[model samples]
Target chain A: MNLTVERVSAGYGHVRVLDELSWRIPPGVTGLLGPNGAGKTTLLHLLAGITRPWQGAITARDGSASVLSTGKEYSRRVGFLPQHFTFAEEMRVLDTATYAAWVNGVPKRDCPAAAWAALEQVDLHSKSRDRVKSLSGGQRQRLGLATALAHEPDLLILDEPTVGLDPAQRLRLREAITSIGARRTVVISTHLIEDVTYMCDRVGVLAAGKMAFDDTIDELAKLVDEDAGHGFGSAFEQAYAGIVARLGREA
Target chain B: MTDTAREGHSVEQVLPRAPKSTAPRTGFFWPLGVWYFLAAFVVIAGVTLVRTSLELSFAYEEWAHTNGLFQRSALDITGPLAAAFGAYLSGRLTPPSRPYALPRFARSKAEFLAHHLLPAATVVTAGYVLGLVPIVVKTYSTATTGSLAPLGFVIGIVILNTLLVLGWLFGVVAQSAFAAPIAFAAGFAATLCGYGIGAWNSVTPVVGDVSTAGRVETLAFALFRGAFFAIVLVAALATAAGVLRTRGFQRRLPPVRVFAWWILPAVLLAVGMVRPPSPAVREVNPPKICKEAVGMSFCVHQAHERDLDDLVAEVEPIVVLVGQENLPFTRVEDTALHDGANPHLDPTVYYADVSPRYGATGDRDIIANLIAGSETCFVRPGWEQSAPGYNAFMLTLRLSGDRESGADKRFGKLSDKQVHQWLNSHRNQIRGCAITDDLLP
Candidate 1:
């Protein structure tokens, strides 16, 4: 399945967060990398249909599956992990994940399997009996991820997935996502270039509610390598600086 | 050629760190033992309250009251479980929370609101149906005269429905201070409906010399009592509803379903039951209305009871007791002969309690006549003393009218002495004796 976002625009109240932004994600790991206010999260929201774009259309489709026109249709094949992890702290991990599976319309026959698989996927199967509030931040974040994946969506959209995770936890997630990512599409949004280099196939850098650039990791490397000696981090800094300086010049 | 496309494409593939979506909830875990125990305690408390307070028969207690928050009482024990369910099903349920963005299928707000209000309407409609007891009664009584039309039933239904809805809404939002006023008004409507309909038929004309105004006064009394009973019942159910709403279903409490609905009808039923009858009031050892002329104290049964001859014999002196409907006049007559007074005695007449005067014609028939007669000076408040003065005034008027007709006093001048002399000649039926005792209702 692929998602097509054509010329979309959206905002919070009077201030527009997305200004006629548009892009597409075919089935694979596509990374959205941007500075904090670059609207990376906003783009994910628009594609997911949580925030309706003021000026464009988003359509998602898969072969042998219904084309999704709205959220109800979109969520069937797509799963999203919002940057804000609002775990019902009062809820226990296993029960919470199980209910999410049920709510997402997993077949009754498949529900137990989905719950077990998701808990095991997050490495929280040991704490399945524990209340969410008892979990550490990284575990909670992983728990959030597992809940989203439990329904087995074709497309997984995560905003800041490795946020608040230590290197070890991050490494564990990288392995888990790599395995889950074989056939399903995964879009990870983050500013960390290291994550994009290791995890993303096609990377889009969003700046000022616009898609500043869209290219594969190899192609992005080439853009940074235009200046031969600079490293990846220095190249990322240069690319971000170039966009900001250009905006200042235009303004 | 360089190994097709590069040094980075070595032995192993590095994985991407993508975030997973949030799951609904983990699998069901047994709730804390303490909570389970608390639920059981509350359920037991509720069942006991209902049973002891009502003293109902054992067979009716059944599973509803007996389950006591034990596993038997509930399918599952999770406080606020439904709201969590709502949040969980937030994805696929009809009338969704908000629109989904892209690939995920989620419900819209319109869909959720429709589902939410359906059960609310059904509950209110059911309560409204129960509140229609008054209108149904209006249908059966002969006092209403004509066959109540379909329109009347419809109007009653509308009014009762409005009251029931307000009562329910008032409860759901009980936390708001504004709900108190709605609750009070609903209570007033309840009283007017619950007791006013049936009881109004009996107390309409009023027992004393109060006016059609008196009927209004009595109605206001009923409204006060009715409002009190109604408010208590509705408020209780409303509290229960509020608890359920916040707690997500009070996992331990057996489903009361529409507790307020049932309780309101029970209150109405009680109001109907304990009210003093239309013409019969049972008072606690009230002074007997009958007094033997032999100077003995006696009481007649409450309204619609009389021992006439016994009354005459006991009050050989009283001659008139303003309201004598309670005195066993027939028995008083028998007792009077035993006391050796003339069998033919000038009877006492009461402007009050005229329902007995028009006996067998029924209270409904004499409503107008009783209302008119009861308003006279002798019966009105403070008029017990003023009655003699009015009688003197009427006597003066009679003498003066006759003086002009007799052609001696021209048109005006008949002194008080002449009026007195004329009154002695044309005095009222049994009016010669001064009124000794002014009795009360």
Candidate 2:
């Protein structure tokens, strides 16, 4: 599924967060980068169908129907992983995935198989019978991803999916998400430029609630002054810092 | 990714799906915590049944003649116990971050709230109904006059459900660790106040003192109480849903038109309050059970027929002794056998006190009271010490093998002819409470 946000304005209790922001997200691994309080979480929440935009509209690229009109039909096709989430600690790993699938409108009978398939994707299939409380932090994160994938949603929105992880665990998650991104649209919001350098094909930068840049990672690397730095990491950081500076001046 | 891992993923995706017809059914109370709730139901109901059976055996005097056993067994502590369980379960189930943790899915908010609240209500209500089975069996075994009180059960169930909903709402709103204990205290206090306050007692589910003869609970009054609590239950549900809506778990408030339906129960409650059903027990004439022994007839209320044989056996020897001594009364009847409108006793018929203390000692006490004459006229000063009828009463007790002070020896010293002459002279005084010390042998 392709999502198009048009001139959207939203806020929390009179404090405006997103101001006339518009962006188009296509299928593949797309990375979203922004500084603190740039409405990245708010934008993800809007795309996940959890909160409605105060003004403007979000619709499918085909323009068949708006998300508000489609309601549950649109929600059924999307999966969301919040920045901080927890599960019923006593629930078994497989039961957690199966419950999520059923909640997302999968038929009850298909839930277990779907859950197993999703867990296999995240490499957590061996721990299906273990209680959630017994899982390591990294395993729990993978379990969250399995829950998101269990219903086979067309659009997957992940907010800070790789926040607290060791280097080894991060590499494993990156591989899992990269594999899933091959056939679906995966929007990953994070502050780590290294993740974008490796896993994302396209990158979008948000500054002051507006899209400051949206292009290929190569194009982003090209924006860096080669005379100042040559390596990929320094170049990407320099280019990202320069964009935030220009957008701050504009604001 | 390695070819092996890719191949494994592909295999998992096409793994054999379980048959749809045999799929595990999922709903409000499905594959997750339902077994725990089922276990709770069985334990609670089983314990309540055993407790009620023990109470019936030990305290038969309070519930023998009426449907008091069945009615009180279902209501008394079961309602508050269920309310406390509901409060604790709901409080534990609904944590502070539940709204944020729960996924925004295709199911409606009302359905979601039902998913949380209905399991507790259902389990507790089922346990309560199961607990009433013992009451029914005991009533069937013993009682022969009054039928089981359906209205009492209906009112009890309504009150119980109302308390459960109230407890659930408290747990959801308070979201505190103390919610369960607070709800338990509140439920028990509410019941105490309902019974203690005179005005509320008439409308509360606990109908006190239904053990009167020919008296049974009235239907209209019970319906009034049931409707009142049922309306409270509806209001509590609406309030709980509203709370969830504000928390963003629910997308919409209940429809405005639903409030219009409250008018019916409200009107019924109002009519009941204005012209309350009177005389909570209405009089009904039921059949009597009677037996004959020692040339004397014994009759009892039909409700006590199960105990008639044992009673006749205990009192038959006493009746023989009374006949040998030429006692004035030749017929004995239970005091509960009279018509409700006329309560006068026959002068020649001995009216036995039937409802108290139901074993061997209690039966012997009846004959002792008869020989001692009516105690109502013995309230005069010095009657206890100087009354000659008391000596004769002690003599009868001694003859019956009950040990008393020297009355049996004093009476034994008299010749049979002399004893007969003294008793013949004082027979009227002994029965009429007119004897003096000078009349003693």
Candidate 3:
């Protein structure tokens, strides 16, 4: 799946998010990293077609003329887990998956099996019968991931899926993502430095709606050792501090 | 590859090996369809009961020929059943189908009417069929009664329920499933409103004279009370329909087929109206002659002429008036169904046409006059049809000299002294006597 963001400048009323930002997502895990208010969530939303750009456009591989949300082609193939999500408390874990299957029109016969398969992959098959209200915070997050995959979507976008999970749950989530990444493009946005080092194949450091660099984790480690007067931690911190200073000067 | 297989795995590959459990389609249809059927039946039955009850009354002919045994029992079961069906249908058929909330079914609307509005009428009609049981039991057999003025009573409720059911249907179709109850409430209110409108316009249609039934102003009361809410019922249905259409409820649930068992009876009744009234039968009304004490000078007279030959032969007789000096009969004015012997003396003419056993007629009026000085001396032509068993009395009147001339001539023929001897001898045959000069011309 080729997701091309072309010269897209979008913002909420009075506040800009993506300022003339453009990127092309090839078929692979592409991590988006940024500090607080760096427009990371906005960029993710724009890419997911949940929010539209105020200016410019987005197009998939067919090069069809882009209109935000009018084309649900991406939505059909792309699975999205929002930063903040809530489910009906009375609904069982299995039911959450069943509902998504119905909404996506998977017919009646295959829904139950497909839902079970997704739960199994997410390592939550044992707890599928439990109501959502009874699940732990970590279990709920895993259940959300199972629902997103119930339809066998090709592009999975998880927004801070591990936000509140304990270390063990986060490790399990990371492992599941890594396993799924072999066939599907699983993109996740996170703030933890170790998550990037341990899980991501490549990372993009975005600051103030601008990409500082997009490269392999190896390249980032080598660059820090060879050139920065600042330490690795300071160098990573300066990456955002330097861009905001320059953007402010430019304004 | 065929598109079917390409879209997903073939059906063969996906089947879960589970056996089918009866047809789901029919399963859904019966539970849902039965509700609609019952609801429709209730609507029709309720209106029929109320209308039938109001048309029935306490008439002597009605009492004689038919004890009302069948109608009494039939109404008892049908009345409450109809109401229950209405309430059940409204509650079961529709519930909330909003995006998030759970649905709610309705219970009852207008606690005031309940079974009484409709069932009470039915109870009266089926009275005789149940048993002679009692007079009260026979009259109030849930079926319509003459005393109730059922035409307006029934029309009023039909208009009310129609407005409600249709209006609620409109809500279901137009808005979310939640608005169904409003339609029902509107229906109950609509009936009352029609009554009120009928009352205000004095458009109430009454089939008989009610003065003798003792309830005053039956027509005016029925009109204002009946029509007030009829318009309301119609308006409610119209409003609900308009609202429902806009909301697109037709797209969601199955269409409701309105089939009511009550419709059969109602249609039969409607057709019965055009079937030509059954030939009038002389269902007799027993004579009301008060007893008198011997040697009373100041006696109250309340009796009519009786054909002596027909009476001795056991042929049902006609009563004739006795001049003063005839054995005098004095009536207690307080008897039920009696108009005092002298309503005319008070300037308010009453009991000339009140209810009777067969219908409204001269017999009730005669009884009215005896109890009071009202017009009881004559029966108008075709008057036997109203008081059926009074054919002999009417035949006697038809043969009598011009009514205006007869009263004065008969009085003049009897002199005070000469009439006294004739009256004193026929004390058993003549209820009233005394050859008093003031008793006649």
lDDT of 3 by residue, A107-209 (tens): 4455566566667778887777677789988888888887677666666777888898899988888877777666676667887766666677776766767
Docking outcome class, model 3? incorrect
User: On residues A16-120, what C-alpha lDDT tens digit does candidate 1 reach at each position?
Assistant: 877877787777788887777767777887665555677888887666544544545565566777776565556567655654554555543344456667677
Give candidates' CA RMSD values in order: 17.6, 6.6, 16.5
* Model 1 spans with C-alpha error above 4 angstroms: A64-71, A225-251, B1-441
Off by over 4 Å in 3: A62-69, A223-251, B1-441
**TM-scores, each model vs. reference:** 0.46, 0.75, 0.43
lDDT score of model 1? 0.45
Backbone clashes, candidate 2: 0
| Most accurate candidate by DockQ | 2
Window of ten residues with lowest summed lDDT in model 1 chain B = B70-79
Error of 2 at B181 (Å): 5.8
Best to worst by DockQ, what's the order?
2, 1, 3
Candidate with better TM-score, 2 vs 3: 2
Q: What is the lDDT of residue A144 in candidate 2?
A: 91
Query: Each model's C-alpha lDDT?
Result: 0.45, 0.67, 0.44
Residue B172 displacement in candidate 1 (angstroms) = 13
On a 0 to 100 scale, what is the lDDT of residue A224 in model 1? Answer: 54
